[model samples]
Target: MIKGYKTQIMDYYEKIRYHERKALQERKDNIKREHPEILDLENEIGRLSIKLSMDILRHGNADDVVSKTREAITDLRVQKAELLVAYGYGQDYLSMHYQCSKCNDTGYIGTKRCSCFDRYLVKLYYKSSELAESIKTNNFNTFNLDFYSPRSDGSEKFSPRDNIEQILSYIKNDYIPNFKNHSVNMLFYGDPGTGKTFMTQCIAKELLDKGFLVIYKTSDELNKDLRTITFDNDKALEESLINCDLLIIDDLGAEQITDFSVTNFFTFLNKKLIKNKKMLISTNLLLSDLTKSYTERITSRLFGNFRLQKFYTEDIRIQKKSLRQNRFSEKTILNQ
Candidate 1:
């Protein structure tokens, strides 16, 4: 999906190997100068290792002889290690280092891509998607329950604070910890500025931090991406949407409701649901109006596959702006 990203990662691995080999050579030169005896022992170890390989190839040699040769080489290696430590150098001082020892700084382990490579790709995705900066301010640690009222209204069973506390508990304690095990998707519907998008962002940050490939797009942004997939035939972008760990679509009804938009929306959601890729959708539209708002096929897939939750609270944007104004007033009074 990203331009020249594979080449960039390959270059990173090449640089790692180059620097490590250079460092190893400097360490070897130091050893050769100060501890020539240790260097001589290392040469002997190399010679014996070559002999062991040759003897293993020689079918004429018995197993006992090969075993004896390996034991002697091991003794010399241990002795050399002891001398190096005694002289204040680490035992591995002459060895080349790897950033990711599993893949030895290469993006792949054998033929398959390594977990470290996935992390790098995720980093690039987050950086490009603007999620890295967004999560810095909107994560779980920055979330505040004080904005929600503790007093219950007659329309709901509990206070906004109580309901949100329950929702947050389920998301943080249960859902997030068992994200991999559970195949459930989520639907967050609420009044605008009632913390629907904020909670969705919180989940995004949590999952992304755990190394999940999370793609966040507003409904309008997704509409444009779908257009690109249709017009440009971007297979990588399509694969990313269909195969990511989680796809978060915010403001479901904000896009222009054309026939094309409705059709593409249903198709994308249906594909993800069928493939078992998790998704979280947040919308300002009422849950009851969903049938009226969307096509029958879209609503059917949503109600069947998604675990729907309704957010309830006064506008958090208003509350936060008010809080900021109060802080400014307090600061001014203090200065006076």
Candidate 2:
């Protein structure tokens, strides 16, 4: 992954260089066609620059010659800019352009990586995660409130749509803005196909777009990696899980439970809370079920730290499938 990231950064630099060269050549060609004398002036500047370099190399202590050459080069640059302006071009027309002037199209400023480079790495990490393609379509804008029923059931006062809307509003207004300062943990627990995972993905997409480092993994995948730490001595996945700005674990109850999983889950939750890192977990199990499966200590940490939101919606996937079938039937009838 590191190698791939490096290759991607280098590719971006190459593209910048390629476009810069192309634009410079086009400008030079236009100048040569319209004002041929400008080319002669450019050549004179280039020759003087070469001469200055040679003179400095030959007589290192020749302060007079070096000073004269420096003044001559400065004069040539002023002349070049004036000529460009006189020719109906910008004064900086011949200057080398860069996409990012801070790093001059390179991914680093000295030894540290630029913010742009960090964003690229975050994008790469998002792409490398599971269900990455869904993130493009599953953000807040694409989330449909229509899929959730607004009518209250006999047992519940608030409808699914109202509950979900409140949750979304809270996330947008409070959670995301204060994410860096607060360790806001969320637990989405409900039935399958009730948009639990969808909501988590929407949160992840929003945070990722805000340039936060979000590491998303399924509970099964996370457990498999955590298990490897004991046998294979692999710490890469563990480090990422704990250190990411936002760690999202999907389908929390679907993973195989074990002694190690229970112990590590407690440790992971405690550590993330201590570090003030945010976490979002989606699961199909209820609070009681979770308590029965995991220990009271594990459940206590989760209930104590995380804001639990129970999804009370019908199966949206089934509704979508039905809608698709209806569309297909309508198209078939139209064709007939």
Candidate 3:
């Protein structure tokens, strides 16, 4: 990941430098056509500066000679600015433009990363993770409460919609803001199509927009990558899984279980929990299934460290499909 990030930053710097050079060349072209003397003055200033440096190196009186040369360079710069202003251009028109003046198109300000560099990394991460596309369409604003059942059917007191609304409110108002200081992990378990995955996406999108690094992966994909690490010592995927601000493992029970898979899962989970990194896991497994599939220690850590939310509702996909079919049938009858 760091290698990829460095490569990307270098590409960005090259692109910016190219633009700066092109812009400066264009400005120089205009000056050559309309105000050729400005270029000549700039050339003279450069020559004088070089001569002053040579003189200082050749045993001239350092303080007095350097002060006189500095004054001459300052005066020449003032003339250049005056000429530029006379031609209705900014004084710094020929200066190289930078997206970040603090870093001058570099990714760092001294030893620290510039804010522009950080933002660039965040953007690159979002794009590489495929979250950029999903985040646009799956944020809190687009989430529909109508998809969840509004009324509880006998067994439950609150409706699925009500529960979801409460959860959303808590996440938006409480969880995301304090996430940097407090590590909170969540587990959403329910039947398929109960909006668990959608909720997970929603949270991921929100956290990502808030400038937190979020990684979302299905259990099958995650398992395959983890298992591959056993054969190859590549630790990039594992490092990202453990280190991102929010890790969302969707459809956790969908993976083919094996001893190695189970051990890696436990290790990954424990490492994140120990480091106080947040995670959100969505699975179709019941509490009983969770206990049966994993060891006591694994299940214990899950139950102890994660906030478990059960999504109790009918299959929303089926409901939506039926609703569409009914609408189509009604339209057909009306046409007849």
Candidate 4:
């Protein structure tokens, strides 16, 4: 999973570095404005720190001067920390912060990858292969409305094609264009092979191309993550799930049903919804059937918070397979 994402991981580290650098500068500016005396002490410490290095390298400079310069810088730093604490700030308020202090948000310690990078790779591994290859052909450009018949079979008011067109229109004009400001959580519910997951992948690729972090996990994988978060205390997995631009949970009813799964899942789902994070759920279960699998409270939240979209079409995989077989038969007859 990490094989194709080396550049992306490095780019993430670069963003962290840029953010930390800018934040340090902002803190410095605030300190200078609020307390000039402390800022002056900080400046003197910086000068002596540089002078200590120069004295150590100078040929005629004695060791005594270097040691005294080092001591003076240390004493000034202690005073600065005391002042920051006295002024209702952390002792290390003026210091820079790093997401990964071991690597200083660089993703590597010297030449080797850091533990944080490995954790990122683990999260990436949960992404389904169906999604990984969906970008090449399953996007909006390749979505074929022709596969859905235009004629209504009396199942509902509109034909499959008309229904799908309405969904795609909302996706294109309303959802993707104004993703940030106009985010709406969606529940894509349907039986198997109804193109629910494919459309979800299409949206995933679209947002990812627009520079958003989209995390995809099947129900099983999400349960596994929740278990790890509950027992193993995996903060990285929890953070990724909560903070991704859009989280797509495919096949939501397939995970093993247990007390732990139900408890943790409801808690996780509520947290994300309360935070107003964008999410997409594709479930084979109907809205009414969800009560059999999950608590009524969970179903109510899903129905209340998420915009429901029902998918109904012939099994696309089977349709494609039959078409391929018909083509092969025609080719054989022509050859014979």
Q: Number of the top candidate by lDDT?
A: 1
Error of 1 at 281 (Å): 1.2
In candidate 1, position 136 carries an lDDT of 89
lDDT of 4 by residue, 1-336 (tens): 223466667787898889988998999899999998999999999889788878888933568888788789889999999999999989878888999899988888999878787555544543434566767787888888877888889987889889899999999998999998965999999878889988998998887776666888898988988898889887767877886778899999899989789989999999898888889999999877888899987888899999999888888888999999999999999999
lDDT: the better of candidates 2 and 4: 4
Q: Clashes in model 2: which pairs?
A: none
Model 2's alpha-carbon lDDT is 0.83
Candidate 2 lDDT over residue span 296-333, tens digit each? 99899899989998887878889999999999999999
Candidate 2 residue-wise lDDT at 136: 84
**Regions more than 4 Å wrong, model 2:** 1-3, 29-40, 43-62, 122-132, 135-161, 177-183, 208-214, 225-245, 260-275, 291-301, 314-336
User: Any idea what lDDT model 1 has?
Assistant: 0.88
- Name the regions of candidate 3 deviating beyond 4 angstroms: 1-9, 55-62, 109-113, 128-137, 177-182, 228-231, 235-239
TM for candidate 4 is: 0.66
Worst 10 residues of 2 by lDDT: 1-10
Worst 10 residues of 3 by lDDT: 1-10
The TM-score of candidate 2 is 0.74
lDDT of 2 at 307: 94
Q: Give the distance in Å from residue 294's predicted Cα in candidate 3 to where it truly belongs.
A: 2.8
Q: Could you estimate the TM-score for every candidate?
A: 0.80, 0.74, 0.84, 0.66
